[model samples]
Target: MSFTDSSKKSDPANPKDGSSSESEKPSNEKQPTKTRGQNKKLDRSSKPKTPLPQKMDEEDLGICIQITEKLSNSVYAFGFRSPPDPTDEDGQSYLSATESPMDFQTLLNKLNTEGYRTVNEWKNDMNLIFDNAFNYFAPKTMRYDSAIKLKDKFTDLCQMFTKSEEERWMIKIEKLCNKYISADNEQ
Candidate 1:
């Protein structure tokens, strides 16, 4: 799947039109001086609470697609590939048992739609697919065994991909930190 532009956009909250909001303007009233720690807290609090979606690069996206494809193609994947049909008896029972039901097909849809912001988000949803299965079925049951096998397979397949993603994340973080440090020094 093709990724959308990943470039950072200006935050509307901090406008670039040269007009500052009343809250942003320096007040005439003398303000209490904040300590370095307090300044850091304030800076953090001023930023958005939720992280914006970071589009996956081609290599990462390809790896994710490969993993999902493998899981979907597996014989054990039949039951876990789609959500249970609510009209059927077994489906009704599955729906009732699973609080946060996840399936491989849904994961694929999300990937296509760019619903995931990061690799971790994709991984968490994948884990949920297995976790829901594990929770719904008894330990010795065939379905449970299948879920365990699939989960193990997922873990094995993701090792190298995740390690590389982690390295990329660290590098991005370091660059951001350096940019902030330089900006602070200039100010």
Candidate 2:
């Protein structure tokens, strides 16, 4: 199995052309001291080093906790933003912050249950004022675009329903609410 054994078995008629001896003669080339196995073992010993978790300061942690509490108690549940995105930043602030968010279907269901006709009948308690009102019917980017009151927005909505037959208080309210639903107010 050794190099010498192979050389002896070769036909002498055709010489290896000193290729066999070339490996025997050490050249100026630097050789690796360790075998591949040894190198791999060393690599394994080194381990995959990873950065440690950065420690948070107690004060900073406490401050974050405080902010979370304030946001939870803030009453203004923004239609667009969750807790990760706070109220102050987006101005989705509603007077009835504690109210749950309401979509068109939920509003309809509420109307059915409450026997209400117009937003005026229920007041602007739909949580659709300021950010809530503006954000209704608005795309994500245009959500906070219009900062109008619930009543004004309702008026604008009235223009859309030009027909007098649809001028019923409930119908007008439905049209507006369907287009621009904000959040739901608690009982």
Candidate 2 per-residue C-alpha lDDT over 28-52 given as tens digits, one digit per residue, 9 for 90 to 100? 8988798667765445646867743
Identify the runs in model 1 with alpha carbons over 4 angstroms from their true place: 1-50, 164-187
**Residue-by-residue lDDT tens digits, candidate 1, 1-187:** 1123566665547657455565676569988999768765445677778766578665567789899989989998988998889999999888877777789999999888888877778899999988887777889899999999999999999985756657979976897899999999999
As a TM-score, model 2 comes out at 0.23
**Winning model by TM-score:** 1
- Score candidate 2 by lDDT: 0.40
Lowest summed lDDT across 10 adjacent residues in model 1 is found at 1-10
Reference-based TM-score of each model? 0.61, 0.23
Q: In candidate 2, what residue range of length 10 has the lowest lDDT sum?
A: 77-86
Cα error of candidate 1 at position 75, Å: 1.4
Per-residue lDDT, model 2, residue 83, is 27
Using lDDT, give the best candidate's number.
1
lDDT of each: 0.83, 0.40
RMSD of each: 16.8, 29.4
Pairs with steric clashes in candidate 1: none
